[model samples]
Target: MEASKVIHAIYTDDDVLMSAVKTVKAEKYHIEEIYTPFPVHGLDKAMGLAPTRLAITAFLYGCVGITVATVMMNFIMIQDWPQDIGGKPSFSYLENMPAFVPIMFELTVFFAAHLMVITFYLRSRMWPFKKAENPDPRTTDDHFLMEIAVHNNEESLTNLLKNTGAVEINIVNKDEDAH
Candidate 1:
C-alpha cells in the first residue's frame, strides 16, 4: 500500500477519550482505530460500529457441542459397552438421558466459550505471533490512542483533534513505518 499521513491523538482518561470520539464523529471524520488500556463500554456504539455476530457463532458452537456430547455418550453407554449399573440396565438412550444432562451442559458451555474466543481472534486478524499494530506503547499503560487517516486535510484534522481534549497529538507518516 502507498504511504499516507495518519494522525494519532492521545488521551489520558477513557472518559475524555469517549467525549473526544463523539466530537470527532460529529465533524464527519473517520476513526481508523482506537487503542485502549482496557475495554471501554459503549465505545463501539459511540463509534457507530455494527453489532458483532460472535454471539451467533457461540450459540451454534454450543449446539454442536451438545450434539457431540449426546452422540458420544450414547455410543459409549448404550451402543459400544452396554453395562448394568446397580441392577439398572443402561440400554435405552432416552431412558438414561437424564444421566447425561450434566455432560451436555458442561460441553455446551465449554464449546461456546472456547470456540467463540478463537473465532473472535481469527475474525479480528489477531492470530498468534503477529506484529503488534499498536502505534503507541503508552496506550497499553494508562492512556487511549485514536488513529485517523489524514487525506489532504491535515491542518483541519489536527485542529479538530486539538480541540477534542487530546493530551498529545502526533503526525505519523505511514511510509516510514513500512521500512
Candidate 2:
C-alpha cells in the first residue's frame, strides 16, 4: 500500500474551507480528504469528486429482490401447494396473489435492505469488526480540517496552503493520536 505524508490544516468556518478547497483545485493540487463536523454544501463539486452511483445500485438490487420474492412465492403457493387450504381458489394465481402479498413484500424488503448495506460497506472499504480510521477527533466536534499529501515538496505546499487562507496547519503522522 502507498503511504501518504499528510498536512492537516484547520479552518474556523465552512465558507473558509470551501474557499481553500476551490483554491487548491484551481492550483491542481491533489487533496486527500476533507473533514467537517457537518455536511458542507458544494464541497463535493469543489473537491472534483464524481457523483455516487449508490442510488442506481440500490434500485437494481431492489428489483432483483422483488423478482426473487415473486418467483419463490408463485412456485411454492401455486405449483407446490396446489390445495385450497384457506378457502382460496386453486385455479387462479393472480386472484390469490393478494393473500400472499404480505410475505412477498416482507421478503423483498429484507433482501433489498441487507444487500444495500453490504454494497455500502464494501464500497467504503469497511468490513465487519474493522478498526475506524479517523485522523482528527476534533473534526467530529467543531473543527473543519483538510488533508493534503505532497510529493517531495513541503515548502511550496505550505506556501500554497497559506495563500488559500488556512487558519492553522500541522504535520500529522499516521500512528499519532487523533487529537
Candidate 3:
C-alpha cells in the first residue's frame, strides 16, 4: 500500500487546542486524533466524537460481579458447609445477605474496575510490550497534538492550523509497511 501524509499540529495549551479543534471541525477537516498532557474538558464535544459506552459496560460488569458474589456466597454458606455463627444459622442466603453486603460491595467494585481497565486497553488496541504510538513525547508532558489527514490541501491546512495557535506543525508521511 502507498504511504499517506498527515499533519501534526502541536499546541502548548489545551484551551488553544480545543478552539483549534472547533475551527478544524467547522472547516470540515477530518481530525484523525488528538493527544494531550491531561484530560481536556469538552474536547470530545468539540471534536464531535460519539459519547462513550464505558459506563454502560461498567454497570453490566458490576451486575455480573454481584451475581457471582451472591451465588458463591449462597453455595459456601448455605449448601456446601453451613456454619452457625452469632447464633444465626447459615441456612439461607437471603437471611444472611446483610453479613455478605461488604463482600458483595467489594467484589462489585473490583470487577467493575478491573474489567473496565481491560476493556479500555483492548478497545484502545493496547497491550503489554506494545510500542507507543504517540507522535511526540511532549504531548505526554506539556503539549497537545492534533493529527489531521493531509487530503491534498497541505498549504491551506497549515495556514489554518497556524491561525488556530499551533506552536509547532509537522507533516509526517506514514507508510503502511513501516509497522
Candidate 4:
C-alpha cells in the first residue's frame, strides 16, 4: 500500500524524532516513511537508506561530454571543413585544440549538470509538473514526521510511539474507521 494512507506522526524536535525511529525499528515495525525539513545528522543511517551513486554517474557523464566535444571539434575543424589560415597544417588538430577549450569545458559542465539532475529526479520519483507526494507539509518546515504501518499491532505501536516522546499521536487507517 502507498505510505500516504498510514497515520503520520510529526515531531518538532530532531532528538525526539530520532529516538522514536530507533524505538520503532527495535520493535520491528514496518516504517512507511520519514520526512524532515533538512538533512538530519546521521538520519540516513537511522533510516537504513543505502548510499547514493550520483558521483559515479556524474563522472561518467562528464567523460561522455568531453569525448563528444573533442570528436565534434576535430571533425568540424580538421576533417570536415579544414582551413589553413595561419600557415598551420589543416590536419594539425592536436596543436590547434586550444581553440576548442571553451566548447569542451562548457559541454562537460552542461552534460554533467543535466545528467545529474535527471538522475536525481528519476531516483526521487519526481518529474516535471508532477504533484509531489509529500507526506506532510509541516515536514518542509521545522517538523519531522515518521509513519509506520500498524498491521495487527496498533496498540503496541501507539504505546511505543508515546514512550519514544511523540508530542502528538493520531491513529489512522486507510479504510473506513481509520479516522
lDDT per model vs. reference: 0.91, 0.83, 0.93, 0.81
lDDT of 1 by residue, 1-179 (tens): 75798899999989989999999999999998999999999999999999988889999999999998999999999999988886767869998888789999999999999999999889889998999988889988999999999998989999998988898999899778666
Error of 1 at 100 (Å): 0.8
Candidate number with greatest lDDT: 3
Candidate 1 Cα outliers beyond 4 Å, as residue runs: none
Candidate 4 TM-score to native: 0.82
The Cα RMSD of model 2 versus the native structure comes to 3.2
Clash pairs detected, candidate 4: none
lDDT (tens digit, per residue) of candidate 4 on 1-179: 53334556778899989887877787788777888898889777877777889999999999999999999989998999998868877677788887789999999999999999999999988988987666568789888888887666667777788788877767665454333
Candidate 2 weakest lDDT stretch, 10 residues: 170-179
> Distance (Å) between predicted and true CA of 104, model 4?
2.5
Q: For residues 1-179, write the lDDT of model 3, one tens digit per residue.
A: 55699999999998889899999999999999999989999999999999999999999999999999999999999999999988986868988999999999999999999999999999999999998988889989999999999988999999999999999999998673246
| Model 4 C-alpha lDDT versus the unseen true structure | 0.81
lDDT of 2 at 119: 92
For all predicted structures, in order, the TM-scores are 0.95, 0.81, 0.95, 0.82
